[model samples]
Target: MTEFQTIHPLGDVPPQSVESGDTSGITLNVRHEISMVQIFARNGREMELAKKLNIEGVPGRASETRSFTAFPLAPGQWMLVSKNAPGSGFGTGIAKKLKGIGYVSEQSDSRVCIRVSGSQARELLARGCRLDLHQSVASKGFCAQTPMAQVGVLLHQVNDGPTYDLYVYSGFARSFWEWLAHTAGQFGYSRGGRGH
Candidate 1:
């Protein structure tokens, strides 16, 4: 059997930034390929299933895990994210482990992630997102699904630096990337081709 290798949508590109007289910000990196899974309750048994699985359970709306992130997508549904963990096949492994507790589907290649951070991160995001990204409201671990630049995305505020991880459909990856790059251009931004 031939082993299919995973790939980062953007690889080793380097950061792009513009600095003019002390005002500078915006940094973007294509997060490294990691295992991602979407798990949904099989029969309105979300809470039960989550509890049985044991990894931070399913997150509440607008919340995420500090160690291994799990973001709620809707009632009875959540997406599990493992950053920098080995290769793919996690979803299948999880399904086998759960064994009929919940329905698990692989999302490793179905979506692409972009990490943006810095002082200007929130400011840049405000231009295209309607979510209230205020530190007090969107503190670390806050997560939401919203339309950014007219594209549906899973947004997570990951830290005090107000860094954010934006996950979008792989099909729309390039479009989303262009929008992010162009929006951040005004404040001078940097880009990383590979590894979050």
Candidate 2:
């Protein structure tokens, strides 16, 4: 049997090789195999659903379980993200677990998740995103639904390095990538590997 390797949306593109007279301070990579699910609470089941899912604190923030992270997009809407490791069936299992309590639709292929990390990550994003990404304000686990280069995106700050996960529609993946690659060129970035 021939084993197949998954490729990211921008997998065909070579790592940028031009030395723009500056050191590349960031790593821009596609997270090709993350499992994502759109979760909507059944009427009047918001808090119950949150509690059942072990969602901590408030909305517009992220909560983590053992292997899954939930990003609240609205009062009753959320996007659940999980690393698609072997045996990780986030969407399917969550749907089964929430049976009559909420709706879970697999979005693992509907969008592309791009991760940007390093010293200039925030500066690179500032060119296209309008959010106040300062660590003191956005902090860790803060997420927002906003537009980047005119493309609607879900931007999540995962940590202090201000590493971000940009979730963009698959239809705009190439366009988004082009814009990002061009803008990040200023700060310099290296292409990275297939996702976790």
Candidate 3:
């Protein structure tokens, strides 16, 4: 029997270290093999679903717990993300927990997440993303669905380090990465290891 291996969306690209002078103003890290699940509450069962997930009702915005990060997609709909080992059945586990209260669909293979950080992170994103990323408007825990480099993405502000997690469809990962690399060139960027 031939054993198959999983390939990351970015293929075999090595971690980049495009920088000038002594320091880099931006950093990029690809988060590989993350588990993503989309949940939609059953009619009249929104609160029940939240209870099962131990969240404070359905999130109106992005919310994070020790195990999962939930992002609102629409009314009573959300995308939950977690860092679980590859093929760990993370989505299946979430589905079993919610059971009949919400519908769950595995999205792990369909999307990719890239963590963009450092002092120039916002500036680099601003070059293509139209969303208002001003600190006063997009503080920690904020999230939005927007287009960057002409690709639709779910953007999440994870910390005051001003780090952002940009979730893009797996098929467009390389394209988006190229755009990010090119745009970040002006700011001098460093790439971190995959799954970091």
lDDT of 2 by residue, 60-87 (tens): 6899789789998888888988987524
Cα lDDT over the full model 3: 0.81
Between candidates 2 and 3, the one scoring higher on TM-score is 3
Q: Give lDDT for model 2.
A: 0.80
Q: List lDDT for all candidates, in order.
A: 0.74, 0.80, 0.81
Error of 2 at 100 (Å): 1.0
Among all windows of 10 consecutive residues in model 2, the one with the lowest summed lDDT is 13-22
List, residue by residue over 48-114, the lDDT tens digit for candidate 3: 8877787654333687788888998877788999888647988888888988788998888888888
In Å, residue 57's CA in model 1 sits off its true spot by 7.4
lDDT-wise, the better of 1 and 2 is 2
Candidate 2 residue 5 Cα shift, in angstroms, is 12
lDDT-wise, the better of 2 and 3 is: 3
